[model samples]
Target chain A: MSMGRRLPVYLLLDTSGSMSGEPIEAVRQGIKALLSDLMSEPTARETVYLSVITFSSSAQQIVPLTELMSFQEPSLDANGSTAFGDALKVLEQCMDREVVKATSTTQKGDWKPLVFIMTDGQPTDSWESVADHIKQKKLGNVIACAAGPGADENMLKKVTELVVKLNSLQPEALKAFFKWVSDSIKTTSQSVAQVAADTPIGLPKPDPNNMIIVL
Target chain B: MNTEKATLKDGRTIEFVHDQPRSGTMKEVYFTPDRKSVVCFYKDPCAGSDANRLQRLQMILGAYNPTLPQSHGGAAQNDIEADYYRKLFCWPTGIVVQPRFGLVTPAYPSNFFFPTGPVWLKGEEKNGMWFIGPKNRKWFEKNQPSELGSLIQHFSLCLQIARAVARLHNAGLAHSDLSHNNVLIDPSKGMSIIIDIDSLVVEGLFPPDVLGTKGYIAPEVLSTIQLDLKDPKRKNPNARTDQHALAAFFYWYLLGRHPLDGRRIPPGNTAEEQDLLAFGSQAIFCEHPSDSSNRPEEKQYVPCSALGPLLYDLFIRAFVKSLHSPSDRPTALEWVRGFVKTWDLLIPCSNSSCLHKWFVFHNSTDIRCPFCGTRFKGTIPFLKLRAESRPGQWAMDGQLAVYNQLPIFKWHIYSRVFPSPETDRTRQAYCVFHEGKWFLVNEKLTSLTSPGGNRVPPGQAVELKDGAQIRFSQEHNGRIAEVQMIRS
Candidate 1:
């Protein structure tokens, strides 16, 4: 029989001027740790395909959708302004090219994608229309995290119902967020493996002790 | 992170460790201090009716507990009986009423979660029933003697599941959510454990709270879900639906594909609609005998015929005839009988790399291993048994290919010896084809007589020859089988 359907996970990071030093470094290290943890899980390794997208002056597909074993941590030199609109457009394009649609002739298709958007500052460019377009397309379940005090929750809320506000972009707090992401991905991948791809995916409960506020 | 303690009806107090409760969609499972048992606290408070159902289930379990065996009458035998039920099921042992509504059950052995030694290093764990999917076969490929080592092992596993479900059904309980997710399979051990017993439907006392997992739900149940909840025609999961799930489990275990998942059906406008059609009103068996439209892609899967015609017929009855009619579905007992008969017909494949290392004997002029497509290079030995269902009456039950080290169960020897854990160890004998001769090795049985009328005692061997009659036991109802040698 054919291998299990692939679940594409997109990580959209805001590598803007505000996220220069520690924040960008934390994002890089967090993704590396997530990849390592996912690789250790056989189910996740087999079914989860991950991608990395970064937006500063413009959005770029730093890493295309690939298996965890082949995933490489992309270096983010934070600069310019947060082009969130460009990021959404790039995400839509990547999904269009990368996601495999289910068909009648062949039931082979990628599972519904899970998107994680982490931003430390407010969007400098108009992103509402593009975000609305992608949400209407029903491409995936988007969870937007507003990292640090400068990030706007109202803007993030426009894109997805699942939104979290990190108190600060500290290494420990970022680690906790990434850990939650890893746990959620593991749980979702396992759920997909057990039931149909369209079955509601259960997200992991956030750590109450870790100051990552659920908004 | 303080642990809360609750007292059960039996005066036993269980401390629930709330610090790291494993949460699911409906409940959060916490372990006791001793780690011997777990308490599942439902996220939502149980309704009065739900509590009544739990009480009824407890009563039912108490009644089903086996009495101490007279042969070994002691606390030890009682403990053995308790362990027997525990091994057969992850049955709830007690009810918890403290921090939240919950019930307690024995913790699954650690081996149920992960393999030992090198396999753990490879990050392979039991990981629930998904491991048994055809695509996940590669996970166990590295293990010695592959998980799908032979058709006999698959038959044994399926029979074990059937017996467990049959026992539950006989007790008037139905596993509402019977699916791969609720079952755990250890392929290396060829064993399975049914979990989520809390959701069991007790006739007249309780109704099913959940319909079932998607693919395993009966077509009739799915098709009628849109009707009003109070409608009499609205089908709820019950014994009949359990039969459908049981049949699906057997098919998937043996064939590695869902019985209703075929390419012939058109995709619906929505995924939910597709599910409703594919597994419901428009469902069709992928391997329906008369229709090849829904058959699996030849390059990806072997036909269900690999299990032999006896089992294939049962699949047809289950998925073809019973797709729309619940009454037409084969019962668990019927599946058990079919598996036992098909198991007897298997012959070892000559190719070592073949995933299924055995295939059913076709009795054709040219015998080929259906699994690896390899032809037999030597003469094959067949054992034709005469089944005496009654005194002074005998009939040709069947013929079995004598593969090396093929097991001989009690049912094959004695018509009365049924298959169960109690008789499992005592009823085994084996056939060995070695050194250009075939012999029956008496392992546990005491009675074996050769054609010359000399007794072959337990642990002795008797050469099998053409037309040789061998009595398996000296009892009044003992069965004697005739040997038939064929050269092609």
Candidate 2:
């Protein structure tokens, strides 16, 4: 479709064994609510293109980057271990294939992609190499959320500077985090629409009582 | 921190609650204790020039109270004028000192901004630009049709914006950053409020601090981008640039498309370079008269031609003929006149499903809804009014679609002044189009007469026919309008 710049938002969710019951259900409902909320905003509806990459024993491209109007919330189920390394690889490949790059010609590139990764525990796989590789490519702003007590903040910090730790695995806290994510997306989309800038937007202050910045 | 107090230069103490302060690009805004006003504290301290500009602006605003008649004057008229100016602007009410440099302005009404909903659990609203985007506008039209109002009402809203800008320009001030983002519009009531008064450019005294919002900035300003800030050749936002922004805004509001944005992406290595070429020195109107490369895709928009020849001509002057010439661009006053004329020419569509219920009376042989392509079946009545321009000469001053209870403004009947509640009563006359015939009722105290010397007093009506001539008032050089009823 002929349109203005697109804001590609990637949800790198961790459907690991630790996030099996209430946490997984919350993630599912949270993703649904986030999609619905983003779709409601005119700027988000116009510029945001959503994609889902769930990582557990291995990474899976549950949903490719698609416009919000046509995006469907994929059914996510928890399994095996958190393979962060494999997830990083898949994310890098996705960015290479899906994200349009600006050239010295007629084809204009998309806005910088915003990536949100949520995980409840440490990565079972060696993710540092892949993480370093993607970081070298400098593919947009990446926000990593270490959900629940067992999540590794130190390890996630290596992947992105914007790392937040959720104190509890309660459904309410998870919902609030997702709501913040959606709000951030809304802000980014609006900023891009206003000036077509590729810079990172100032995020809303996280709930200090429940969510704490690690880096 | 719960509450903080600061004193203005006039010794008026104002209290602000620090519980929830909203941070914008340049300043942090906090609501006053009473919530009727907002105090904006700049993040960075104002430079000497900026401080001087603010002081000068305060003086200008203080001396801007509109005059009122003695009989209708008093605190009530004062309140009316106060409300009028307030509605037109979010003028800074006071200046702040102490912890930081700040300006205070009245809090916007709840409806002035779009509700943020669950995004900002604490109530915050997005500015008007949120609604003007193509996709958002489409969503609003589809989901909240009533809020979009009719096309005529949209034209009126455009007129209000132009009038507000004209008022500011007349006061020797230019809204340096005039764009969709700085203006708040309530489409339902056809009302608009221009915000960011603090950044107004006062010519030699205050010079514009910022360039302008992207896309709305003039091509001339864009051409000077490579120049150093201190370079004499570098252009700044001024009255002429504001005119460009106004034209851009009008085009977007009426057509739901950017005047310069087109399918041809300028060759560049970066998005910034592309934008610079697309909206700057090499800017081209998508609907340029000679250039077909950038014309909007068919079926997606109501063609500019559908807006009627009068408005279409103005759009041409705004976007095509004057694209590069700042002085050649139509002024805000001209836009107001064009919009008023277009508003007068609107005819309601027979198609209930028509997105815009009204379309301009193109005065064509085949009358059809421009939006829905539905044919207008009945004989549409078009009234062309000719008023005396000189002692023995007459000129066509007004034309209107004769719809049921359509109001005829004082400006239509009087050649001297335009209509406003403060100037003239709401309307001078109203037309009733019923059952193939038309009747015009005199609503004002001024006498309405036919060419046959038959006077129709107030509360009385007169039959309107083809080639009818009516005398609108008894005052000196009273308007004599000749009506030409065109049946389509």
The candidate that achieves the highest lDDT relative to the unseen native structure: 2
Cα RMSD over interface residues, candidate 1? 5.3
- In model 2, which regions exceed 4 Å deviation? A1-3, A13-41, A54-57, A68-82, A100-109, A116-215, B1-9, B15-35, B40-81, B98-101, B113-130, B207-211, B221-228, B231-233, B269-273
For model 1, the docking class works out as incorrect
- How many clashes in each structure? 0, 0
Q: Write the per-residue lDDT of candidate 1 for residues B103-184, one digit (tens) a residue.
A: 7887776555654434323434354344554434554565544444466666666777787787777767788887766776
Top-TM-score candidate index: 1
DockQ of predictions, in order shown:
0.20, 0.23
Backbone clash pairs for candidate 1 read: none
The docking category that best describes candidate 2 is incorrect
* C-alpha lDDT of residue A151 in model 2: 88
